[model samples]
Target: MNHESQKTTIANTVQLGSDLSVNRLGYGAMRLTGQPGNFGRYADWTAGKQLLRRAIELGINFIDTAESYGPGYNEELIASALYPYPDDLVIATKGGVLKTAPDNIRTDGSPNSLRRSCEASLKRLKVDRIGLYQLHRPDPNVPFVESIGMLAELQREGKIRHIGLSNVTIAQIEAARQIVDISSVQNRLNLAERNGEDILDYCTQHNIAFIPYSPLGAHPLKRGAPLANAEGILTEIAARQDVKPSQIALSWMLHRAPNIILIPGTTTISHLEENIAAASITLTADDIKLLNEAQVF
Candidate 1:
């Protein structure tokens, strides 16, 4: 795997389900909310709106959000910023999670809860039909089929265009498929986390979109923070490419698999631009090999 001459370029766009097509590099809106626990409305609402508009101007058509983010403010913020969305823009949101406080979050996958969540999201998003609605997480108390079946019912009723799952396993995905057609799977994946590799492979084989949240890792790494082997490899590659270490980390994922769709979130304009620019990076086989062998945190 040392092809220095041959370079692999990531595709610009990927198809979601059958009809919807989104950019391989998408924007995640979780960071736009209040800090500490993402518990309340964004302190700088105006700035947040501007950042979102800039995202679309930068060719990011896929925006990922969840009802749990701000509990309901995130969806409203999106609608406020880009309600009359572009024809090609795709908004994917999640349900089944309830958050009253930052420290207190729980999952409820029952049909009644899902139905209410879907309807509320429809209202907040100001859309007749949601582009994509995902189960935020599976509840231990509720049967998995019942939760997926509820989404299926909503799909049939024209409330949700496509169904997806988040924080799920391969067994859960296979189970959900029996109840409805799963269009995507959202999981945590980065250079430091490879636990979701098998699930990513499964989605790739099935031609299902695999959305990787936390593409920069779940725990934020501050400037000059120590990250052991993963950071060393990323820094070395970044130095060689004359790019940011974060960009190198993201580019590695784009080269890892074809089906992977990234939703890296940032609050600043510069970071947003850097993230979108990562899609243009073409990694060599050697670069990929080194990144693949890097230790996971």
Candidate 2:
């Protein structure tokens, strides 16, 4: 097993208000589900429990999940594994997308649905207050403020500690903040995709943590791209550092912004450990330059 035994420290940690202090190196629990055709197929109940426990032992203090993950199975798994959860860990989950049969997905931003989903998530995660509750996506049928207004109400009632948004444009981010505090933004970003660079830059400037989902590019990456496509410079860096391309890619994101948090997912302990180990590896200035250069095109 090629383990990332490097021992480097992050430059700084982001303060998400008074409720939590995130170390910036976090885990994404999306892979903890039995999603069809997912690389990290949600493992058996026993395997899921072990993986969640191992994540904590590796010093990962932050976790990201969604109510749509497993449609509820993922939260129940977290409860089964980490119930009576640690006080220091920050668990972030999102709502707003309604998943039905035959790969059908829809949005519901009605105040009643938002309230009900938040309450149901509480029951599944087995927690009283969500560390970071995010509105998964904007609902075209409903006004953005209307959806966020409901979230704000939840925070006021002691049901949530912080608020976040996902898969939204900068304009949407600004709009949502008008109604509630926006602590973080989760967006699709990876070596092969740089569409969210501007949002990332905006977050860095404002001290908001930018959580990059799919830090590993989605399948069918450009030919010879690293980390996902396995063809990009990430592969080259991995070879040089004796680490996995995925680790190199993750390290790049961590280095890209002081306030960035990575939530790479994995089902097996080996992959999980490898993902966690990226935190300890520090890239050189030359490494950064090389990766950025390849970002062109």
Best of the candidates, lDDT: 1
Output the TM-score of candidate 1: 0.95
Identify the runs in model 2 with alpha carbons over 4 angstroms from their true place.
1-9, 37-43, 219-229, 295-297
For 45-91, candidate 1 gives per-residue lDDT tens digits of 99999999999999999999999999899999999999899999899
Model 2: clashing residue pairs? 33-42, 224-231, 224-232, 225-231, 225-232, 226-232
The weakest ten consecutive residues by lDDT in model 1 span: 220-229
Model 1 segments more than 4 A misplaced: 1-4, 220-230
